[model samples]
Target: MSITQHQTEAGSGMKPVGKAKARFGTGRSEFVVVAVLYAVAIFLTVGTATMNVQGKSAPGPQFFPILVCIVLYLAATLLAIQILRKPNVPDNTVHPGHGQFSADMLHDLGHLGKEEDAAYDAAPSQTPGKTWKTYSDWRTIGLLVGGVMAFVLLLEALGWILSAAALFWLVAYALGSRRPIFDIGVGLLFSSIIQLAFGAALGLSLPPGFVGGIF
Candidate 1:
């Protein structure tokens, strides 16, 4: 919010709904995402512990999974810290008083504040009111959900490379990127690299679709 806008709202006797955004850098939903990422990291770590090693000397299949989990943990911890540092100001209730009352009403502070609240409430807004839900981009969320579903259903048939590429492309598109060729190329490159690295380094086998021959 700009200085003038905030001043205007304050002048009108209205308290801002969310002031923590300045410190947190994001909203509650992002915190939930961080928590989910943290949980996934822990779960993956536990699963990796049970993986059988081919040899005691060399790094086992557990190495990559454990590494990934560590990265997730680090990311989650940073995000949690960011969210926790933000100071939240408690909301004060606005008690409306009759406009007929003067500055010396029954309340200790008097009716001045109450009259302002009543007037602000009664006035019609020049601009349409907006809430958190209004700001949310449901199209992006729907695209993400659809992408995940498609990725899951087509994983085996399309293989790790193609399925992952498609998922990445879908996510990029949802985020407003329009360069289809570049996005798909980058996604394909990344997916191919991951597949090759996991398969060649730790003997992890990913599903091989029809186009798997190129890799």
Candidate 2:
């Protein structure tokens, strides 16, 4: 074939490939996902904020849920804005030689390559760095659970003051506290404050057990 004829054929073949890339790019897919997430956040915020909580306290049942919904809405809005501002570039051009098939196959298939495969190959390796660390911290979690369990078991028999004090010390030690004198003092202080606030001020009747007459 002559040079002019060969150049004309090559240019005609590239036209379909360009059109396919434009049809199914990453920008369109990301926009759709972000939009859906934002819609869900708005629905949750509006639905929960309007619900009534029948309790006589500063923070009723509805307080925490409403706070969480507001946070979700704000985060989703920011994500959507960021996605909108990002430039839309053809996937194949961004990171060359990463797609499942060559440019010739994409032109012949008349479709943009699967965008997710390209994204996955482009992602950075997640191999741990010097800052990374492993943990065998089940002992800590177990100690905390045991402490809470002990409090629940002893509350009715030992009273809130003794039960809560023991729980505080156990949990503090589990969290790596070493000073026994300070730990015990802090535990006593915490239990006493809780007794005063919940039992006396709030009029919530915690089990008094053996020391029922003292308080």
Candidate 3:
């Protein structure tokens, strides 16, 4: 083949890689899911929404959800546009690490025993790719989902305080919290504050369960 013909044939044979560009923290799939969920929530909100009869100017029940939906939709749309415009570059830096909250707590708590510290030290450099086929940690995702499901199942029985505390602790532990004592303490404290803020200040009644009198 002539040089120009050979070059043309080679160029024709080469295919461009069509990778989807996404934000650093969030993937395109995640963005799509969030957008869809927000849309679903908006629809659900619309179905049961009612305007407040107590006051003439009171915002309808669906207003907040609609507003949130709009914001989420805008974000998702922007993300989609960006993805379509820019091709995704392979990222080696996108390795799994201990959850930010848990990692910070461990840092603040100082060093533990040498044995525990040794084990803990390895977590920072350990990539999910070492054990898993993909960069994303399905184990962490499963644990998070299971924790949320457990919280939902236990919520009515255990009440907001206990359930929320358990949920917080479960998430922290799943994310590699080294100090159980601190995790539990922080969870309880955080849940209590949330209860106070919502139940007491906002007058939003939360399930008190067996400990109704205490709260």
Candidate 4:
């Protein structure tokens, strides 16, 4: 088949394969996702507030989760509203299927088809690297996920102080911190603050683990 036909077929094929609609694009998709997240957050918040946790002289187990949910829902709702109102105008300068699918376009289409492909391929990687061609930072997300997983796994064994310190350092490193001393210091400080807030102020029992006696 001709290159034009191939590109048309490829573009059409991509349309129905994912949740992404051409009309929504990336920005709209992000807005929709945020909106949905906020809706869920609202539900959880209201649900938790209704739960009966009438135990001791302290707030219920749902107290902090409800507070966080309220904050997250509000922030997400505002962001979604802003994005919906000011829909991002995609640069129409570079049409993907224009100029009859050249060898370069075919190569790009192949890469785009891969399971590990980026959401948008601005152009072939051979093109001069432009500032606008980058996607959201997936590395930071990976680091956050890894840190959360590690914190969950190690919290009981290593205790809140160590686990939270490690989580903070990992997240900071993921966000591009390079100075080990600074990262460690900041991590310890933040972890200690969290420890004090949850343990001392909130009267919540975090895993003291090996350091239980000292605390």
Q: What TM-score do all the candidates reach, one by one?
A: 0.63, 0.40, 0.52, 0.60
For the record, the alpha-carbon RMSD of candidate 2 to the native fold, in angstroms, is 14.4
- The lDDT per prediction is 0.75, 0.68, 0.65, 0.70
Looking at model 2, residue 151 earns an lDDT score of 90
Top-TM-score structure, candidate number? 1
lDDT of 2 by residue, 108-127 (tens): 77654567446646663532
| Model 2 stretches with alpha carbons more than 4 Å out | 1-133, 213-215
- Arranged by TM-score with the best first, the candidates are 1, 4, 3, 2
In candidate 1, which residue ranges exceed 4 Å CA deviation? 1-29, 87-134, 213-215
Model 3 lDDT vs. the true structure?
0.65
Predicted candidate 4 versus true structure: per-residue lDDT over 78-149, tens digit per residue: 887788787765443222333333334545667324332332354355443333242567888888888899
Which numbered prediction scores highest in lDDT against the true structure? 1
Pairs in steric clash, model 2: none
- Looking at model 1, the pairs that clash are none
